[model samples]
Target: MARPLLSAHAERRTSVDYPYSETMYASVHHERRAAFGAELYGALGIGSGDHTARAVYDAESLRFYGAPHAAFLFVQGDGEARLAADVGAYMQTLLLAMTAYGVDSCPQGLLSFYADTVRAELGVTGGRLLVGISFGYADASSPVNQVKTERAPLESTTAFHDQGPSSESVRP
Candidate 1:
């Protein structure tokens, strides 16, 4: 039932404006709950009965103020070493996907600590906790989002060798 419901929600990615009000939040929460309710750990294969381990879990246990729009628990299966880099790459993919849908996201790595709780909850072994992603529509009015930081000039940021074998042939 939950799987079907989540699938339905994921399928409904048409033009819809989800305001930052409680009502819209409730709707998103319901879909999230439908997709990841009590059976969350179980669905991910680390329930109470089973002894299977995981690398990620819920953020609610952290006891923060406002709830995230949605949380996705990711485990480091097989490729634990490259998890962080892989995650960053995937996040950029998510950003592109969201952009197409008129939505925005802020891929965060700051939650790696809280992900510890997720590991503890899942009783995972070997692999370490990676990070958690908070996905939602960007608040346009947010000054943080609106402010675009500039980068150093390409020459300062990039390193390159002489274009030719002769020192006089290239300009540094």
Candidate 2:
């Protein structure tokens, strides 16, 4: 038997006037995804060319909110990407506080996919739901909770220059 989704955005068919805060996403460059594909997939234990394992992990990560309580962050439809930065900072603060209090949290961009669900339940309107954060005392026994991801070296992502040195003295 086929099951039904409780909150499918396709059924509502609402036009999203607000753009996703990601500039590359709005620009529609598929290659942008490919650029980070290796790092992201590698951290998830997805082997090179292992499409099946990748797909499974993707679905699993997107589904499981991983926490009991969720807080949605929304901004006015007219808000620009700068507003997203402020919201991100605020969210980080919340995460830090949660960590200090022995609470675990998961920040999921996947939550934004079901914006309609949030709107209807929370009476939210005139704003774009940018992200959702789920927080609760963690279940340490869950294998999913133990999954870890590695971060790329800062030098790989940053560029530095020596102002008082030769023109060729640049670092990456």
TM-score of each candidate?
A: 0.42, 0.62
Candidate with best lDDT: 2
For residues 1-172, write the lDDT of model 1, one tens digit per residue.
Answer: 1233223334542211111234645564565544443354544456564432432233222222122443433646576447657866876787788778976554434344444344444565545445445556655664334444344477865799866577567566
Per-residue lDDT of candidate 2, residues 95-151 (tens digit): 999999998888877667666666776887767788877778777775555655444
* Backbone clashes under 3 angstroms, per model: 0, 0
For candidate 2, what is the TM-score?
A: 0.62
Residue pairs in candidate 2 whose N, alpha carbon or C atoms collide under 3 angstroms:
none
